[model samples]
Target: MNIYLTRHGQTEWNTQGRLQGWQNSPLTEKGRKDAKLLGERLSKIPLDIIYSSSSQRALDTAKIIKGNRNIETIIDDNLREINMGPWEGRILEEIEKENPVEYFNYWNAPHLYVPLKGGEYFEDVQKRSVAVIDKIIKEGKYKNVLVVTHGITLKNILNYYDNKAMENLWDTPFIQGTSLSKIEVRDEGIHVPFFGDTSHLE
Candidate 1:
């Protein structure tokens, strides 16, 4: 199985540097265009199904990428962004000012970061996202699968495939909006061929 993973395209909150969390935001013009560009790039690839986060931003990107392909596009809550809870929709700067230590831990030391006001832990995000992926893999029905999700969620997913510790969660090759990553699953094992590739956007 060939699994294609991508973060949702840029949104208003993305440009504003807000904590979107589970909030809903429409895609910016560039977001839509980038999705279309990615669609064109994947046009020739035979994708059998698409799994997207329930978030509108991710669903929109998945639809745009689906284009005219007659495949089922499923939305899963497990694929949603980390539930930022009270921090949802808040500006990143404000969050940092209000909760400096936790904010710092969130970026630099993920394993030490603790969620505030009902927010999800990084481990929680990873478990749920990986559970969904394992379900897909167990189904064994699709040859090519496309997964559209949030930036943090995508990172958690990639981290699972790479077997990196939680401390190194925010490693190199940042997951850009609409950037593509590929993982091939075979009888041998899972192999990540490429990650955070934005050649389609260029």
Candidate 2:
């Protein structure tokens, strides 16, 4: 099994520094361009399934990659960005300025600070993400699968791949728009790697 996961393109809220948790925000022009470039980059790869978050941002990006292919895309709510709840559209700096204690931790130890007023816990997100990923790997049903998802979800998922404790989920780096990360199941075992290569967006 070989899995490829990508972050959705940018949106107005993303460029404007707004917390868009589960918000149905559309992608910006630049975001669309990035997705287009990503599509061109991935067109050559043989894909078994295309999966996306239920959110518009992710589906929109996934569509771009589908292009003329008849690939089917499944929308999964579990793949959505962290739910910000009360602070869905609020500015992070404002939240931090007001909550100095949270701000310090967010800066010094992001693994400790919560993203927004009512965001999902990092540990919980990591646990769920890991379970989902492990199940997919174990199934070995698809030779190749493409997933378009959100930032926080990717971070938590990567935490599992990187062998980082769930307690430091936020320590995983946030991948930018159209960035690609992959995992492979060799006959010997499984291998999760952080391959810093994004020639598709060139």
Candidate 3:
């Protein structure tokens, strides 16, 4: 199966450099335009199913990309972004200033990093996200699957497929908003054609 992964379009929080976490935010004008461009690009590909995060931002992006494709998106909570707990509505700068040590650890040494109060652990997120992917691949119903999800969730999957260490979580290049990544999964192993492709926006 070929999995096409993409992060949702930019939200107001994204532009403001806030931690979106599990919170909701509407897409900006450019976000919608980029999504439309992605839709136009994806329309040329052969997609059988779309699995989208339940988050509003991801759902909105999925709808835009699926545009008249006659494919019904399956919303899965497991695909939601990492829960930021108290950091959900806070700006990233504020979090960095307040929790300097932990924030530094999060981006640098993620294996030793801990989540905010009431937040989930990165390991937990990876487990659930991996479970979803495993189930989808096991089903073998769809040959081409598009997963519209958040950055961290998508990164977790990428890390899993690449067999990278937990400490290397943030080492991979960032997944840009509305960008596409194509990976092929076969009986042997996973193969990535590309990561963070935004030519459609260009």
Error of 3 at 72 (Å): 1.5
- Each model's total of backbone clashes: 0, 0, 0
lDDT of 3 by residue, 1-202 (tens): 9999999999999989888888989999888889999999989888999999999999999999888889878999999999989988788889999999889987898789898788988888899988998898888898999999999888888888888898999987898899998779889888777888999988
Tens digits of per-residue lDDT for model 2, 8-122: 9989988878888778678999889988988887788889888788899999999988899989887788888877666678787886777777657644665676755466766
Q: Model 1, which residues run further than 4 Å from truth?
A: none
Ranking by TM-score: 1, 3, 2
**What is the TM-score (0 to 1) of candidate 3?**
0.97
The lDDT per prediction is 0.92, 0.77, 0.89
Query: Which digits, one per residue and each the tens of the lDDT, describe model 1 over residues 1-202?
Result: 9999999999998899888989978999999999999999999999999999999999999999998889899989999999988899999899999999999999999999999988999999999999999998998999999999988898898889888898989985788899999889999999788989999888
TM-score of each: 0.98, 0.89, 0.97
TM-score of 1: 0.98
Error of 3 at 148 (Å): 0.4
Give me the runs in candidate 3 sitting further than 4 Å from their true place: none
